[model samples]
Target chain A: MIPAAFEYTRARSLADALKAAGTRGTKVIAGGQSLVPLLRFRLAQPSVVVDIGHLPQLQGIKRAKQGTVIGAATTYRDLLDSKLLHNTHPIIAETTAGIGDRQVRNRGTIGGGLAHADPASDMPAVVLALDAVLTLQSRRGKRSVPARKFFKGPFATAMKKDELLTEILLPFLPQGAGTAYESFEQAASGYALVGVAAVVAVSGGAVTHAAVGITGLADTPFFAASAAKLIGRTPNKEILRAAAAAAVEGVSANEDIHASAEYRLHLARVAVRKALTTAAGRAG
Target chain B: MTQTITLNVNGQALKAQAEPRTLLVHMLRDELNLTGTQVGCDTSQCGACTVLLDGRAVKSCSVLAVQAEGHKITTIEGLARDGTLHPVQQAFWEKHGLQCGFCTPGFVMTTVELLRDNPDPTEDEIRHALEGNVCRCTGYQNIVAAVRSAASALRGSRRPGAAVSGG
Candidate 1:
C-alpha cells in the first residue's frame, strides 16, 4: 500500500512551511497519522507534501490570560503528559487519552485531527463543547474561526487549501463549571459510535450555564440546542431525561454496519444524559 | 523521485535513498535489511510494525521513512547486547508468551516501552497497553504473564542504590 509519488519538502521554519503550502496541489503533513492513511488509500493525491511536524513554532501548550493555547502540531502524547492541561482542562486530556492506542497517540496531532474533520473523531466534539477558537494562518495573514463553525461535513472543514491551522485557543471554563465526555466506541477502530460532551455550570442549586456537543450521529459534529433547556432550572433526573430525548429531535442520524440509525439515535440520547449527569455532578 | 536521507537505526547512522511514500517499516526492512520488524495488517491496525522512535513506540508503517531521518529508531534487532537476550525477550521465552511467534517482535517492543514507563503494571494495565498489538494465536494469557515477569526482572535489574517502591 504505497502512496503515489510526490515531492516532499521538510519546512525549515514557519515561513518556509507557509511558502511551500501556498503552491497548488500542496498538502501540509503534520504527525501524518491521518494523511498517510489517506495517501495510501489513494483518497488524497497531492503533488507536493510539506512536512511541518517538526516545526518548533507549532509545538507547545501555553497558558494565556483567556485560556490555554495549544500549538497545532502538538501530539496527543504531549497533551496526556501535560500537568497544566490536567489541572485546567482535564476533559481534553481524558478525551485525547482514548483517541487511539498508545502508538497512535504518539503521532496524532490535534490540528490534523480537527482539520481532517472526521465526524467520528473525538476532539471535534470536545473542542466544540469547550468553545475552542481555531486560528488559521496563511501567507496573507491569520484569522480565527470558532469551533462551532469549523466543521462543514464529514472529512471537511472551513480551512482553505493554503491556510494552516496554527493554534487552538480553548477558553477557560467559567467558575463552578465542570465538563465530561462520554462515548460508545466501535470495538475495532475505537472510533465513537455516538460520542457526547457536556459542560455544565451550577449556581445556587440550579443550572446556570450548559453546553452539549455531539458526534458520530451525523455528517458533522454539532451542539445540541436542547441543552439550553437545562439552564435556569434544577437538573433533576426527570429533567435530564427529557432534555436527552430531544437531543436528536430534528437531526437525521448517520447509519452504517456498526449501528443502525435508530440505534445510533438511542445511543446519542443515552450518551447525552450520562455526560450531562457526570458534568453536573462535578460542577463546583 | 528518491531522496537520500540518513536514519539512526539501532544506534547506527545509515544513509539510504527512499521515495516520499516509503514507509518506515519498508525502509528498515527492505533498505536496511533489518527484518526483525514485521509488517502485519499494513493498515496500521496491527502493531506488528511497532518500533521505538526516540524511545517511544510508534507504528512504523504509518510513519514515512523521510520523517524518521533525524530521529533515533530502536527496532527489535537493537534489543540484545553481547548475544544476551534482553530481559523482556528472556521473559517472553521463559513464559511461553508466543505460539506462532509472528507477533512477538511487536509485542516485545511494546512491552519494552510499557515496562520502561511503568516498571510494575497490573494485569489490566498490561492488557490495556497491549490493545494495539493483536495476537491471532490467542496467546494473550502467556503474553500477560511474560509482561509481568519482565516487569519484575527489570525492576530487580535497576541500580542497587535505587529506591525500590513497588513490585
Candidate 2:
C-alpha cells in the first residue's frame, strides 16, 4: 500500500523549518524512521512533509559546561558511535544498542523517537532516568521542558503543533555514578515489553542517589519517583527488592496482547531490580 | 505534487518523477527497475528493503524518495564488479546462507554495512547485528556462519570498492 500524496520541502535552515512548520498540516521529517512507517499505514496524513534531516542546526553532539547537548536529529547509530557519550554516558549506548536492529538505528533520530513517544521506546526511559531536558523551538523562540514533563501519553507529547524538538540536554553524572538500562524486548518487533533505566550514585558503599525510569508497563515512560526515595539507603538485596517493588506503585500497567496488566507489573519489578543492581554494582 | 528527483543509485545518477510520499523502495523497484531490494514486509520491521544511503544501511521502505535526494545509495545490485561477487555475497553463496532467497538481498546489503564498520565480528556480534533482518527458511545458523565467513574473507581480501556502474 502507498501513503497518501503529500508535498515535500527540505528546510535549509532552522528559520526555514520553522516557517514551513507553521502550516497546520505540515509534518516534520527528521530521520523518518517512525514517521514514514506511520505514513505507510496512513496513521499519519499530513498535507506537507517538511524535511529537516539535512539541517545543520539539528546535528552533532557537544559537551557544555552545564551538560551534554545532543542535537535532535542525531541518529541512534550516531549516539552508539559517540566517544563522548560512551565515556560520559555509556548507558545511552547500552540502551540504544538494544533498540531496533542496525537498520532502524541507522535512521531513527533521538529527537524523532522521543517526539513520536512510542510507549515502548528506549530513549524516553533512558533520557528520563538521566534527568535530561528537552529544548523545543518554534518561530517565536525556544523553550526547555524537562524530559519527565515532555511525554503526555503513548505516541503523544507536549510539543505544540508548530514546534520542533531541537536538543536534549543531559547533565553529567557525578563522579563514580553508574547508569544502566534493562529491557525485555518483544521477540519479533523489538519493542520493550517491560524495561527500566537506572542511574545510581553510591558513596561510602551506600546509595547516595538513584534515578529510575520505567517503560512498557504504562501509557507513558515515567521517572519512578517512589524508587528515587532509595537515596541515602544501603542498596542491599532486600532493600533493592523493596525499591523495585515500589517502582511500579503508581503506574497503571498497560494490558495488551503482549502481556496482561498483572504480568507486565511482574516484569516491571524484575526489570527494575536488575537495572538497579547492575547500576549499583557499577557505582562507587 | 509529482516532481522530478535525481537519485544516485548504484553509482548512476538517474531522475524520476514521483509524489512526495513515494517511498524509496518503490522508486527503486518500480521506477528504476532495481528490484533486488525486496519488500517482504511493507512495515520497517523486516529489513528486506535495506540499502546503503550515503554508506549507512537503512530500511528504504521508511525513507521517502524526496528525502534521499543527493545521497549515494547502494542496493544489492551494486555489490558486484567485473564478474566477481563481493566477498559478503560470495560467502553467502559458499555457506549456503539463504533459502527461498526473498530476504537475501537485505541480508547482503546489511552485512555490507556491518563488515564495513567492524570487519572482524564474533558470532554473537553477527547474530546481534542481524536483529533487523529475518530469514524464515533458514534457522539463521547458516546465515550467521555466512556473515562470519564474509567477515574473514573481507578482512583477508581487498575490500570491494562501492563502485557504481550502469546496470
Candidate 3:
C-alpha cells in the first residue's frame, strides 16, 4: 500500500525546519524508516511531510564535558562506525548495531527513533539507563527533557506537537562502570518483544549504584526502580533474581500478533535477569 | 496531490515531476528509466527497493520522491560506472550471490554500504547487518563471500593502491 498523499517541504536548516513544522498537521521526516512505513500502513496520515534529512545541524556525534551528545539525526550506522563512541559508550554503539540491519540502521536516526517513541525501540531503554537527556526544539524555544521523564505512554512522548527532537545528551558512565543491553526481538517487525538495559557502577566489589531499565513489557520504558533499590548495597544471586522479578512487577505487556501479554512479561523477567548478570559480570 | 522534485541519481542530476505521493522507486523506474532497483514486496519488509540515498542504503519504496529532494541517490543502474561494474556488483557476479537476481541490486547496494562502514566484518556481523536486505537465493552462502571480497577490493582501492583479496 502507498502512503497517503502529502505536501513536501524540504527544510534547509533548523530555522526552516521549525517554520515548516509549526505544529498542526506537520510531520517531521528525518529517517523515514518508521514514519514512512507507518504511513504506508495507514497508521499515520499527515498533511505536510517536513523533510529534515538535509539539515546539517541535526547530524553527527559530539563530545561534551559531561558526556557525549549524539545528534538526534545521527544514524545507527554512524554509531556503528564511530570509533569514539565505540571506545567510551560501547554499549550504546553495540546495542545500536543490533537495531535492524545495514540499510535500516543507515536510514533510521536516534532522534527520530526516540521521537517516534516505539516502545520496543533499542535506544530508549539504553538512553534511560544512561540518564540521557533529550533536547526538544520548536518555534517557541528549546527545552531539555530527562530520559526518565520523556515517555508518557506507548508510542507517546513528552514532546509537544511543535517541538522537534534535536539532540540526545548522554551522560558518561563513571569510570569502572559497566553497561549492557539484551533484547528478545520479534523476527517479523524487528521490534523487541522484551528488552532490558542495565548500567552498574562497582566500587570495591560493592555495588555503588545501578540503573535497570526495561522496555517492551510496559506501556512506557520503565526504570525498574524497585530492582534498582535492591542493588545499592550488595547484590547476590537471590537479590538479582528477586530484582528481575520486581522489574516486571505491574508491567503491562503489549499483546498482539507477535507475542501474548503474559509471554512478554515472562520475557521481561528473563531479559532483566540476564541483563543484570551481564552488567554485573562486565563490571567485575 | 503531486509535486516536482530534482534528484541526483548516480552523479547525474535529473528533474522529475512526480506526485508527492509517488514513491522513489516509481520515479527511478518510470521517470528516469533506472529500473534496476526492484520492488519485491512493495512492503518495506523486503529490501528489493534498496538504493543509496546519499551514500547510505534505504528502501526506495519507503521514501517519496519529494522526500529525497536535493539529495544524492545511487540505484542499481549506477552500479556500473562507465561500463565497468562496481566492486560490489563484480563480487556478487563472481561469487554467485544471486539466483533469481530479483534481490541482487538491493543486496549489492546494502553490502556496498556495509563494507564502506566496516572493511572487514565477521560472518555473524555480516549476517546481522544484512538482516534488512533479504535474498531467498544462495541461502546467503555466496552473499557473505561477495561482501568479504568486496571489502578487500574497497580497502585496496582506498589505501594508495594495494593487492586484491583472495588473490
Best by DockQ: 2
* Candidate No. with top lDDT: 1
Kindly indicate the candidate among 2 and 3 with the higher TM-score.
2
**Which 10 consecutive positions of candidate 3 chain B have the poorest summed lDDT?**
B158-167
Error of 2 at B23 (Å): 0.8
lDDT per residue as tens, model 2, A240-272: 999999988867999989999999999999999
Q: In every candidate, how many clashes are there?
A: 0, 1, 0
TM-score of each: 0.97, 0.97, 0.92
Alpha carbon lDDT at A202, candidate 3: 75
Better of 1 and 2 by lDDT: 1
lDDT of 3: 0.82
Which residue runs does candidate 3 get wrong by more than 4 Å? B81-84, B149-167
Worst 10 residues of 1 chain B by lDDT: B158-167
What TM-score does the predicted chain A of each candidate obtain versus native chain A? 0.98, 0.98, 0.95
lDDT of each: 0.90, 0.89, 0.82
Residue-level lDDT tens digits of model 1 in B31-112: 9999999999857888999999998889998899999988899999999877888889999999999988888999999999
